[model samples]
Target chain A: MAKQDRAIRTRRMILLAAAKVFEERGYQAATISEILAEAGVTKGALYFHFKSKDDLALGVLDEQDSHFVVPDRACKMQEIVDAVMLHAYRLQTNPMVRASVRLAMDQKAADLDRSGPFLRWSNVIQQLLEGAQARGELLSHITPARTADVFVGSFAGIQSMSQTISDYEDLMGRVSDLLRHLLPSVAQPSVIASLHMSGSRGAVVHEEVERLQEHDPSALAVG
Target chain B: MAKQDRAIRTRRMILLAAAKVFEERGYQAATISEILAEAGVTKGALYFHFKSKDDLALGVLDEQDSHFVVPDRACKMQEIVDAVMLHAYRLQTNPMVRASVRLAMDQKAADLDRSGPFLRWSNVIQQLLEGAQARGELLSHITPARTADVFVGSFAGIQSMSQTISDYEDLMGRVSDLLRHLLPSVAQPSVIASLHMSGSRGAVVHEEVERLQEHDPSALAVG
Candidate 1:
């Protein structure tokens, strides 16, 4: 069990290093040697976990699976809001998520499966909207799948614009504004009136996710 | 007169070649030599118009200034819709805009003015929305600037998503869906009911722009 834990630790370390180097230097220009130096691990140790440069990139792509539990809210629509807010928060402060987004969006790194994150995020939104629909939270015209696509695309664009304009420092505000413009068309008036669309909600969720993680270590274990 | 015309033609050729190269190789990896080869111009000719590869990139950035005159409609909100639909149309078919968007969004190309286009686009929408407000075409609570920002960000995100998922084959549909979701919050019920949001609007705008340009060369001369 101890040996298994050590292996997981090494893999995590390697992935972090790879994420940094790949983001800074790009996948084509980034080298395994640089990753090794950044990781402070031997080539033998790195190779034990990742077989190639592509393997290291795949690991980083999967590294986007950072889990934090948000307790059930009164409105599942609010949970949808919280999910995006949490992601924006992490995409701002979390190096791993930032790197993954960069890698996935990089046209130069076309070989990487960039669609995985898009699909996963859309799925998350779809699930929340489904719950909203079940509980009479959304409008009659709003379809979960289609709304999910819009949410995914809009968030991707907002974060991207924020990244370009302000390095995501203003992403929370932009995202808040986005939801304000969009949610009226997606949710019922009663639900829309109750939802929180503040950019600062990210910071709140960030703190909450952190608190939850400390309280229950297993809470962050998302697939 | 002959010499001046030659210079103009050479400059246009170099800009097109540079846009193609930048789109394919990105700013960092793109080479002057590749651009020269693509343009099929001499080194001296290329250098005569563009001082450096960076200058060539700026030229491509400016090349996105394609102008088309969409005729005035009953609803100003429809004009905003037409503008985005037209842009989506142009973005699908126009190589220069694609390259410019790619260049502006490339984080590695941090040396370039990334926010220039986003600000320009948002300003366009803001101006339109302000007009809509004056005419009472918009919702009472909507702010032009914030709504414009959301419009720019959402379109960008949708376009990017379409590029990733379908290489923009479904861009028009996605954009139509986007405006449907957004216009309700931005426009009055009467305006929203009258707006024509469709994928084919792009091709129509493209033809209109072309016809206008054909009749008046100055029509395309946007700042």
Candidate 2:
């Protein structure tokens, strides 16, 4: 059992290191040696766990999939939006997740089947949209698939832009505002009203807190 | 003057050859020697025209910007939407444009300042929205910038998906329908009425013709 635990720990460390290297240097430029050095694992141990660099990259994808568990909480549409926004905010705050996002966006890593994360997230959004539709919280004609695509795509575009700018405060606010305007096209009037009243406030506060941490990590830690 | 003409022809040939090579092998994997061989140009000539591979890639970007010119016709919202739909249809029909689209999406290529073409196309949409706003065809609260982003983003998403699935017919129809529904949210009631009645016809015809051409390219060649 102790030996098994050590193997798992070594594998996890390798995945983390691989993700960082791939994000920073891109998949094409990143080397297994660099990953091994960063993980502080012996070359023999690395070869023991993974057959090739492709296998290791795929392992990193699997590790990311395992780490990103969507929370199952009951909430109104407004709360769901808040949760998603907060999740985006948290991804911006966490360096590992930030690196993962960059790796996912890297064209070089396109062969890594990075679609797994997006597919999972889309499923979550679809479920939420279906729930809203069943409760008549969505517009009668609004197809859940289309709504989900728009939501997911816009989220991706906003995330990509935010990463490029690194100005979380301004971008997050615009994202929230963009979502607010978009909701009315597919969401029920009442849901839209409720969202307008409370959704923006939650998003603003969440984003502000993230911005604070981003601006001064030590200050946030001290606080 | 004769030497200048040879340089221009050589540059054009190299750009075309580079586009093909880049499409097949992707930007990073494609080699300068291969591009030179394909263009039937000497290494010295290639170097004279372009300093390096990156310079050649940027030249491809410039060529694309100059080649794919959107028509500057003033029309109603529905007409504008039809034009957009037709533009997407042409992209589906043209292999070179499809390759260019793929190249544009490439992560390594995304770092290049290939914004010239995109900016021009986006400006056209902005102008359409601005015209609607001026004629009181748009809602008081709807901003041209936001409308342009949504329009551009959705179209881009549609094109991206269509390219992946090779399903242009249904995808284009869905995009057309989505835009038809979307315009009502921002446009005057009369504009919405005009769009539903006439827009549906143009969209259906546009998609049908594109589908036919897609299935049988010789049909277009014969015509």
The numbered model that scores best in DockQ is: 1
Give per-model TM-scores.
0.93, 0.74
Q: Which runs of model 1 end up more than 4 angstroms from their true locations?
A: A66-68, A216-223, B66-69, B216-223
Q: Rate residue B55 of model 1 by lDDT.
A: 86
Residues A1-223 of candidate 1 have per-residue lDDT tens digits of 6999999999999999999998878777789999999999999999999999999997887667545356567789998888888888889888999898777677656566667777777887888889889999988988898899999998888988899899887888898889888888998898888877676887887787778777865544242
TM-score of chain A of 2: 0.76
**Residue runs of model 2 more than 4 Å from their true location after superposition:** A1-9, A28-31, A47-52, A59-75, A102-114, A161-170, A196-223, B1-9, B24-31, B63-65, B68-74, B108-111, B114-118, B161-184, B196-223
Top lDDT hit: 1
DockQ of 2: 0.25
Q: Please, what are the lDDT tens digits per residue for candidate 1 over residues B142-173?
A: 88999999999888888887888788898998
**Model 1, position A29: C-alpha lDDT score:** 75
lDDT of 1 at B186: 79
